[model samples]
Target: GDDSFDEGSVSESESESEGGQAEEEKEEAEEALKEKEKPKEEEKEKPKDAAGLECKPRPLHKTCSLFMRNIAPNISRAEIISVSGDIGLRGRVGVNPRSFRFFRRGWVTFDRSVNIKEICWNLQNIRLRECELSPGVNRDLTRRVRNINGITQHKQIVRNDIKLAAKLIHTLDDRTQLWASEPGTPPVPTSLPSQNPILKNITDYLIEEVSAEEEELLGSSGGPPPEEPPKEGNPAEINVERDEKLIKVLDKLLLYLRIVHSLDYYNTCEYPNEDEMPNRCGIIHVRGPMPPNRISHGEVLEWQKTFEEKLTPLLSVRESLSEEEAQKMGRKDPEQEVEKFVTSNTQELGKDKWLCPLSGKKFKGPEFVRKHIFNKHAEKIEEVKKEVAFFNNFLTDAKRPALPEIKPAQPPGPAQILPPGLTPGLPYPHQTPQGLMPYGQPRPPILGYGAGAVRPAVPTGGPPYPHAPYGAGRGNYDAFRGQGGYPGKPRNRMVRGDPRAIVEYRDLDAPDDVDFF
Candidate 1:
């Protein structure tokens, strides 16, 4: 009985333990289900919280940032942001940082998807106090902003050292004349002295060696030693100095050409190429061929003549001025003497009545005459002068006596007539006798009858029609009589007062006596 009771107790304990374990598993499943649902519930509430926090509704489409311009000077970036925020805009607002006084432009980037056109439309007519704001989309603003950042953050400065070096090299090349000849050719000495003293000195210094005594003297005196001077006699340094002197000479020559002779060096001569053969001056050496742009020898001579002509008058005037100054000082006033340099003509002529050669009209002054000529007859003045000179020469020639004319003696003979059958043929068939019809008048057709039938010619005083003047035609008798003296009918129908009959008859069947009027 004790063992059975113990077994019953064990069975009861096992059942109780199984029931407790199942209840604990059910609670854990319920807790896990609640925990899983909590996340979904929080997720659902999260959107609502976000919506409540947002100050403005989100847009449905992508928004474009805009570059606003023409903003009032008094408006600040914060005010712009506030104004945009009032219009439900949520975006970063940036004003041009470069603006110090008047903030006339800015950029706006939206945080949410919003239609750019709609934002612009709503922002239209936005005014800060009394100042209006202009807003529009500038697609290039992004690129400009990038550029501005780069400029502010990564600035760089470049130097043209290579260009300067190349220029220096070219300058040196222009001055150094390389005199090279064939392998077996003999060297010829040039007789012309060097034009540049600096170049001549450099060449002499390079060729002549320095003595030890001179070197010591220069070193003790703190002056440039002769041996050290040879260091500066490097070909590169010598070439540079020579080029500088040559450039100075060239500039002076060009200035003289322009100021004194009114000649353009570039226009007269082709620019020298560094590659061309060097110019040689000697009895045996010949000059290089003339460049394409070089002025001809004749043109150079003419220019020289004109230059001399212009210079003569100015020199004379300068000499006269100097002499006057000298006389005023009661001695030769060297310091007061006028320099004999010729400058450009800038002297205005006296205001005097000037006549136009073309129109023969008088002008108030030379200026007015010049203006009139330039405006009216500039193109034709040269042609007109040539024509006038030609006519004058022609008139002079016309005044001379004419030479007598010699006439050839005519052969005495009777006038030759063309044979009747040998007369020249007409281009077209002749419809009438040559002299019968006048030019431009149509020829009358000949009336054809039996052969040898003759048509009598009407008398000059007769009417044209045979039955005229008998009845209805009687009215025309007076007109015909007035035109041809009198009308006579055909021989077949004669009438009274007919010139063909040479008689006049009264109307016998009419009234016998005339009544007094």
Candidate 2:
């Protein structure tokens, strides 16, 4: 009986534990179901408009930042900020130094609340002192220019030095001609005595020592010793002065080489590695080989050529990154690109047959198709490309706002000063009525002559013609009108019976008409 009781007790205890486990499992399932429904409940709770449209979070506004370029080097920060404020940009402005703390460019940063597009629109043609501010590019996207200030400064110095060296070297070449006029002939006579000791020494050193000591001489900055005292017009003193002048010429040559070396180094440091950072803001990469120490006029010419090639691109300012990328991708063939674009946007029915994508117009030839596209879709094509180029500049970022197009102001047409009671469609006051006469005027007999036909006028100072029953003389007409003859031309007195004459007088009294007698 004790064993049976114990077994029943154990079974009851196991059943109680199983019951607790089942309850816990049911609660866990319910919690999982609740968790699954949470998102659905949240979605249902979202507020809706009167029309039953779900409310979405508003898009965040972008902060406006503009890149200003071609800034004057000496322009102050306050001036830049003031310029920005003038353009309705209430924000922070700063200039980046392109040369020794002098700035050629800067940037403006504004809060998201400000409308950057409007400010940039007004920023056109903005000037800071003598420099016109160029349109800003993608400051965040483009690589920062390094050592440009030093590069530009040294470039200019090197240019001038090259010119001077070329001239001096040319003079040296011409001087070689003086060493001997013809083969085995006497040396050319100079200002100094032919047998002067100084001239002899100069000749020996220049002809004999130059080639052997060329490298050493090119590197050496050592010049002639100080001038001797009180030796005016002395041959020895004159020779010393000549020697110093020649040494000065060599010094210029040396100076040029040193600057070139410095400029070359600057060029290397100016831009990043092409493979590492391909986006160069469309700046052309130019790096000439290091020049020899004993450079001549020919090498100087080559250097000048390189300078010109580099300076032109720099002067034109940097191009967009899209253009540079296009060049890199071998998409620089403009004609091919144009053809590809045309092909994609248009439908080619056959060899010469084509249909316009825009207007659905058919063409018989490719030329005709091209013309039609140009006439119908030129502006659209340009706009699309411009937008694409703009977006392409932002390789890894959101597109920045663009400035509004500022169309040129059209000149006003010449104002029309129409008198009161006269409509624009009506004849002008000075114009004569053609092929018609006024009402209430009797018709005159035809003279059977052309427009120049002259009729017998009422005498100026005699009895009136019988044809005119009423007095129609010039004096009588003036007296009857109570005024003198009209201002310009003298009046032609006419017979009162003629309708042309009668109608002319009546028409003069018409409103909005000027009387020219």
Candidate 3:
């Protein structure tokens, strides 16, 4: 079926075919995605410029030497600063041309190897002050970028872009400030949020809500499993029941996929750009040349069977009459009408199975199955929601204990206290407690316990549990507490007036069975 599906998907593949230039795009991308798997012997390809000129592949450094070098030169230092500042505030990368083809100009090549699109995507709502510089500089930069390939470069690249972008943007920002400072006025500089991600976290809450709803739905109606892992046996099945289960899962998965497919359409703008099919893999591993192609009729039909299963459980799936009906009506595969039926009046899990705690139906996808469980099992899910909400509330109200207000630690007692003036953080020779000392070794405490305490026998060579000898140096413990002194109170855990934060421990009463997504 996968083979047949491959054949059917071929014609549709071209638009999806990494575009017409996919083969060309990756020849460039692979040079970037050189994992260790690539033979170490393979010579690294030289980078080129738009005019076929050998732009010395000087290290691609800073956040964006490429943008600054190509686009902002003609612009004033002040304006450049402002643009750089805006983008820096906006984030490391910003624009997204329709295709990876835009990277060749060297303004920015599509380093499929460099997945900056995620950063750019995250920056969509990222706001910045408009650069005072004229629009022509921006236009020039665009022209230069347009001259070469860009999008095709992305394949396996990730995080380094974030670090490099942050660093370069800061450098440019500082430079801009020095150049723009008024004759007598002092320059004010801004620093990045110590927190690497300046943006607020919103995904966890979204995912939580989605999971909860799916669980509720699944319990009410027997629905798909949360995950459809790879089945580990023969493809065509011998057991009819097992085959039916697999079919059910595939059907539900198709429904879920339909939602995803619709969301993927660019017109909807719901899909993340880099997530567009092959944008990542094609740019990374499948580079160099297209493998001519693969297609065949038998393969196509086998896949059609799979597609039928997927369509069967959908509420909005397409359909047509059966082959028998179609033939009667002068048509082929009239049974295609079944596609429409697949989506119509689907089974009701909620009305029939409200008594069960978990839905038994499953799909060939983990996500859909999980979604079903969360959406259909509301009562059971409430327990987990309450806990998460409690945790969330704690985060909101619990202040992080203040560092500056933390009081110096109280002098430690016995076992290993370092002598008073010992500077912190140095290791000291260990001196075990008297009772723990090797046989025959005896040390006396300098001072006796409490005035009224009984005079217990000393531990020099006494029996186990006997009081330590009078001269034993008990309070002089050390903690990597540098050279002969006590550590500076091992950094206080809690401080006073300094906006103190609290950390509440879990209540024993809380439920532990709630599944995490």
Candidate 4:
């Protein structure tokens, strides 16, 4: 399928590729199959079986091609991985075109929905056992875990939930042995060193864990975990915390394994220095043993080219979130929402407050019906004053009995005389009394001719300020030009260039050539 055209995604061409197309095809087939199953067929096709044959469309247990007439669209290749124990693809072959649903010679659906992660995870780390629990889930979570101060400090969010399988095989689970998948045989032609490092670590880690469990059962120094009163920090919790750490290691280990399997060393050449670069990549120092050799630069570059061709498809998956899943996940989760808010051009204008129904107090968020039990209505600063005036006028118009008005009493009349022995203080004035004549600005007539007749000074023409904006200078560089302080002698305008200056003058008694017309 052409990965470029997403079902509900962007319109970019050549977007989705092979495996991705498979997933799209899956959705298409399912949709079509569903529509085809609608049973409103004519009763004529087969002398309607006495009891109508349930004319339901039979499901094709097999896969089909959704390849368009010209070419497929919106598909990315699917990852093919090896598994341990049972049900995974059984051959030494890689995934992508070879797997079952994707096996269609023509078309295939390659969606993020297909259970490759699960398949990949189980294949990488399987503990075959007879119990009912699935144990290979640790397969995919090798990377993508929280690492704080190199610590798994908090609960990692689970996705596509393998928690059941994780919980089932947990060290404490009694039913583990029943279904532990056997970590299959190491394949032939020498286990690639780069890929095997994590496998080696996992092998060692699992062995140690298994050994520790056994010793706890037998040794006097160690025994079954004791039940103690829960405290601020519990050992059991700490142990689980430690498991989270180990889980993180496992995740990294899985990624390392995939890298080893998917990549081919380049710098070392076609026949790599097996000792120097056994696999395409490895954790620097942690990568296994090394052997030295020399190869040509051209050979090294060619190797790089070959390696990238194989690895780009693989790295692309890890590098970018599959378009569909990124959109979908980003939509549903708040982190994605926050991420969008931070990274995308989503900007909020401002906050708005509304009155709370229960308390009648102002709040922010979604709006609520206004409620008022007490006389006051919770409102914004602007709206509060309006509400007060509104309520006051409303009561007055309602003809409701109002409180008495409070006003100052007037003074007694002259005929009434002094009712009491007390005299009144200074009386209030109807207007302000005039003060001494206001001072006027100092006279400017002394400097020139009178009130507003002063004229600007005559042409003592010069740079106004030595340090004025733009170019100004102190001393005169030329007879009439100011020293501009530019790199050389200043860039001053000569007197001749000054527009205000009279360049030439003629006298009435001068020679004919110089005389005025």
Candidate 5:
């Protein structure tokens, strides 16, 4: 009975311990489940800020972003935002600090659906204060990025566009003023204004901003400002300004013609046979021969009167403008005017006959006048002597006789007798003999053998023998015989007269009556 009770108490204690361990494991599992659920709820609410406003996420893909490199270190996020707004960009901008101590780079991220390339193109080379921003996009979103400096390439294009706009604006203003001045003329078509909004904006900007600035500058100085002086080495600007002034002058002249003279203008026909017509400026275009139906004399006189009255004032204005420009360019208009007058007078003087300053006598030719001056006045005697000598030399050269063509003496005819010691079986040496060989010496064998003896091999042929006493290829015996004996002992021939006195009586004196001229 005692053993049984002990067993029951141990079993009850073991059951209580096992039950407590199970309860502890269940509580731990429940805690883990709650921890996982809390994170899920936080993710669901992550989009909202602390103030409950919705927050947009940044673009993480490269296709929606542009990489800007070589950004100036001093550039701030606000500047980027301003430039972006100027070009109509809607994006978030972020700058990345360079690895080393260098200029910072930046990235602009747009919505996924936006065309990144277009935005990049618009923002390319955008000026922000002193530094220009170089914007570019990588075709491959994940490719390595590099900076581009294309401002130099785009500068010319931008300048061209600005110049084109200026030209168009000038044209439009001129046309409008012309149409307004002439009530009979049709109004210019308005299609261009509506077709190009960009052009319209440019025109408006020029009229409002650029013209206002120009006028303000002009007003302050009673003329164009010193700061706006024509740039040196910039012919395009000078030409454009000159053209503008010319247009203004034309406009004034046209107004005067239309209002004061009641003259109408039209485009002249380009064909040669057509009657010439007045242009928009009321100037007639006459090409080739004048047609019969020309403007009346009275109308021309009236037009001339109007032109004089209107043109005088315009000319004065132009002169003043030119003087101002010349002053700014550090040039002297008085000197230029003097030079121009001198050149005109010189050209006119050159077209007429030359006159001697001393004698006041005119000559049709410059050479005659030069000669008269030198001969009569005795001026430039040395120069005149040189001129005379040059003429003499020219005449001498012109009259010089052609040189006589010399024909070589016909090579002496083939020898009648075979000269002693000449090679046998060969043509006579083509050289002429100085004289005949002595008689009674038979010709030698071809190979130096005795007469009627067997001949040896001929000498190895080379260049024909040099001209010897008896011509070429004649042996020593032939040369000796030609000289009438051994070498240096030539035979002398008799002459009919005394050889020493032959030239004594020859007369060399010139005749007294011979005149050189």
Candidate 6:
């Protein structure tokens, strides 16, 4: 019975111990569940003071540290501070201490309160001088910290401005003028119109807010630069002070404007009209009074007609004189005419039995007939030559002279047609070879004569015989005195024989033997 009772007590104690172990395990599970749910509740209850007015976690953005590239290597920490202030970050956020790095790269750390999205947007438009900045976020700032010097300085500046405003208000009177100054102080006017007339329409919000207390402020940063008056305005009116000398100069210049305009239009028959002047010629208009004594178009036409009438008589005289000169100069040379007649007619007339037309001599052949006409009939040949020259006027209209049928001169034989002491091979002495001597020059000495010796000449009852040198016996070598002279020089009289002394005085009716009357 004792053994049974001892085993029952031990079994009962084991059951109790087992029940206690199960209860402890259930309590441990409930405590672990409560501990896990505590962190979730804390996460749900975000602090409002973390990101300004908006409730946010401690780490507001994905990153506060920014990788700044394209930073100038020479940029100073103070300059970086000033630049951050310029980005308008002082009031809303803060920056880490010593955020600037070296070289072309740097770092910028903002406080947890900074709106990274907004800062990135503003950074895109910001340039470091001309170098654009490329800012990359490193990581979110999880710490609650504010290490910035720019925000503190900005706050100090705001406090000082407020203090200055209060001090300025304390000294003003009811009229908003300086009432504490001595008797000579200038009264500050309540309202003053702007001195510039152009800005009369524009508002002058900027006033000269000067006071004796604010003199130090004015000296440190001087008043705004004086506004430059507008130099451009309507040209038609004088809105500013005008100089009398300049006005007179302009008036004088306008007075001479018409003279320049008239010179441009002078002698231009086809001028552009007013409508086309601006676009075609670049001339707009003449700015002056109308010119006096302007001739009408009809008067101009009448003047032109009268001018043509006066010119017509001169033109007719010119034409008549030209024809007379052409006819005179066009006369065939006398020797050429004689040669033509001899070559054409002499050969034909003396073909069957040669005959000399000039001397009426007869010969056995045409060669003797030609020699007879050239030597024995030399004087008669001159008359025939003169007839040829005179008849040239009739043949002027014919393209060629009416030449008879040509027959060659008689065949050569043991015969010569030349004068005495001349060879058949020698050139004819009477005919001057063409191009042998220039006009206006003395003829070269004949083959038998000395270089300076003069040759004696005999005329064939005509002026300056064609066989002689021009002006052969004239005392002076004047090229103008003979028939063979140039057309430009005098040829009215013949020059022959020995030189004669001029008769100083003479009467038209004097006897031929008398030297003077």
Query: What lDDT score belongs to each candidate, Candidate 1 first?
Result: 0.43, 0.49, 0.34, 0.32, 0.46, 0.44
Per-residue lDDT tens digits for candidate 6, residues 381-444, read 7887778655664545332334566978886554334457643433355654222233333333
TM-scores for every candidate against the unseen true structure: 0.18, 0.19, 0.14, 0.15, 0.17, 0.15
Q: Which window of 10 residues has the lowest lDDT sum in candidate 2?
A: 273-282
User: After aligning candidate 3 to the native by TM-score, how far in Å is the CA of 272 from where it should be?
Assistant: 5.2
RMSD of each: 38.2, 37.1, 36.5, 36.2, 42.4, 46.6
Report the lDDT of model 3 for residue 84: 44
Please write out the lDDT profile of model 3 over residues 403-495, one tens digit for every residue: 444768876657454467532332122432333333333222213323233322342323333333454333443221223322222112222
- Model 4, 1-517: lDDT tens digits are 4564464366333355666898999999999987776643533344656444576653423211122111112222232121222444422221123222333122222233346445544433432232111222112223322222221121221110123112212211222233234469543332322232233434333433346755656566554445544545433232212245545654563343334332122221122122222122322212222223223335434534553454333232232334464444332433343333322322223476554443445544332322232223333323545554554444333223357569798776685453353223211222111111112211111212232343223233221111222221223242232343223321211212233533444464655433222
TM-score of 6: 0.15
lDDT of candidate 2 over 74-94, digit per residue (tens): 778788778787766655665
Ranking by lDDT: 2, 5, 6, 1, 3, 4
Superior by lDDT: candidate 5 or candidate 6: 5
> Number of backbone collisions per candidate, in order?
1, 0, 98, 50, 0, 1
Q: Give the best candidate by TM-score.
A: 2
| Model 4 regions more than 4 Å off | 1-195, 201-203, 207-227, 230-240, 260-517
Winner of 3 and 5 under TM-score? 5
How high is the lDDT of residue 43 in model 4? 30
Off by over 4 Å in 3: 1-517
lDDT of 5 at 376: 71
Q: CA lDDT of 163 in candidate 3?
A: 29
| Per-residue C-alpha lDDT of model 5 across residues 260-333, encoded as one tens digit per residue | 33332111111221111111122331112222332333544454454344333222211123434434534433
User: Comparing candidate 5 with candidate 6, which one achieves the higher TM-score?
Assistant: 5
> Over the stretch 1-517, how does candidate 1's per-residue lDDT look in tens digits?
9999999999999999999999999999999999999998987878766767776764444435766776766778789889888776766776654443545567676744667778777787878878777788645223211111111111010011112222222233233433334458754344433333323332322232448897787779997845454543323221111223333434444443333333333233222221111111101111122233323335444544543444332223111224344345344222222111101111233456666655677766666766676567655545545555554443343222345569798764454333354323211222221122222322112222221343223333222222223332233323222322222332222122333323346564656442211
Candidate that would win on lDDT: 2
Q: In terms of TM-score, how similar is model 5 to the real structure?
A: 0.17
